[model samples]
Target: MNLYQNDDTTIQIDALNMLKLKKNILLKGPTGSGKTKLAETLRHELDRPMHSINCSVDLDAESLLGFKTIEIKGGESVITFVEGPVIQAMKQGHLLYIDEINMAKPETLPILNGVLDFRRTITNPFTGEVITADDNFAVIAAINVGYVGTLPMNEALKNRFVVIDMDYISGETLKNVIRTQTLLEDETLIEQLGKFNKDLITMAEQGQISEEASSIRALLDLCDLTTIMPVERAVKRAIVDKLEDDREQQAIINAMELTF
Candidate 1:
């Protein structure tokens, strides 16, 4: 859990405090701020089984609760119950992580209200079974603000969980994270990419770019590509190409020119 940042006592303490409360948590942050990574780390630290769902527009009650699938055995057709992540997590006392929860359809989230509040059970309308939540079961969701296709979470859903505001890890910790991920010791390249990422973030914040800010993941991609290609080309393919806007792409090219 401390693998990414050896000395990030702030997040370490915050994570522990959140777990101590044993309440549902919602992590709000900018894209690529390591929100999902934090949730995974919490599950690891707590030693709980983890079930993750990447929330999307298509995810709905049937997809989450359970669905019936037909199975054929010995030429006879039989119906089998297939469990979804949420229910499986509740029954098995695991951590159910909903990544990018705001991307999910509005109708899909009301199911979480009961699971988060004093009412600790979920009913399967399809199966007519009341599934009581286990004490060891918990939920943690991650959301990024201002992302296109994101929905404004309803008030009832917002009231259910204690929210944690997150941002990118500190500069020193980011270097450590890059080192941990790439096992490379090129400090100059590392620093340049970090600064470039910061600049992109600033530009995005200032409404100068419609693309997502460069992330640590993008740096990792650059690291991988540089072993096989030139730094300039790798910067384009692994980082700049992620932006579809021509203007943003040119901006990234200019940034790479200044960095590399």
Candidate 2:
């Protein structure tokens, strides 16, 4: 399986060590910085089935734990409690990946407190059954700070895992990622796209553009578009049009012009 590639191996090494110790991990990074990819890499390395939860404001008990539904079995209607990602992970000793965990509602997250802590267990609110995690069960949660619609993770929740800060891959490593991940074949265009990516990231760091506009994922999308469309059109469609603000779109267009 393809793993996360970066100029520095420190993040990957740290994450692997922590996971091997069965410690919970929290991947903190900007959007599209490969937090989920890193989590998947760890899961693959450990050879474990992963159950994922995409946390959002609408996340609730039924989402985290499980829910009851009526089922017709043996010609009779019966109520059964189906397991959710959390419970399934615990019971099956799988890696639990929670993406954008901070996006979940504040009140909804506390249910996992025991599961995340040394207790390694939680009482199913729906079934009144206490569930303890398997020996190999682990949690890997990711959070993107300073994003709209994201809440500050509770201090207690934040303290549960080993936090790894991820940043955008750059330089030759980024160019390599684009070459391998996209359909674009022009070496010159790849180099130009790489430069454009760096400029956008620099602008984001300088607060001239939102990080969303500078995401590597969006950059890859732009690269694929270049295979069939003009670079300018690809830039407009894949990157510029994604931002609602006219100023941001103009900033990206200017940067594209400078790079191409």
State every prediction's TM-score relative to the real structure.
0.89, 0.89
Candidate 1 residues 1-260, lDDT tens each? 25434243466557657756767888888776777667767876888888888888999887778798999999999988899898999999888898888999887899878887877798887788899988888888888887889999878898888877877654777777677767456788778777877777777667766535455567677876776787899888887777878988888788778877
Q: Per-residue CA lDDT of candidate 2, range 1-260, in tens?
A: 23354445567777888987878999888986878767876877889999999999889889988899999999999999999999999999999999999899878898899999889999998899999999999999999988889998888888888888888877776776777778988999988888898899988988888988888778889999999999999998988887888888899999988887
Model 1 RMSD in Å is 2.6
Cα lDDT computed for each candidate against the true fold: 0.78, 0.86
Off by over 4 Å in 1: 1-9, 211-213
Consecutive 10-residue window with the lowest summed lDDT within model 1? 1-10
* Clashing pairs in model 2, backbone N/Cα/C closer than 3 A: none
Question: Positional deviation of 196 in candidate 2, in angstroms?
Answer: 0.5
Residue pairs in candidate 1 whose N, alpha carbon or C atoms collide under 3 angstroms: none
Which candidate has the highest lDDT of all?
A: 2
Please give the lDDT score at residue 258 for candidate 1: 83
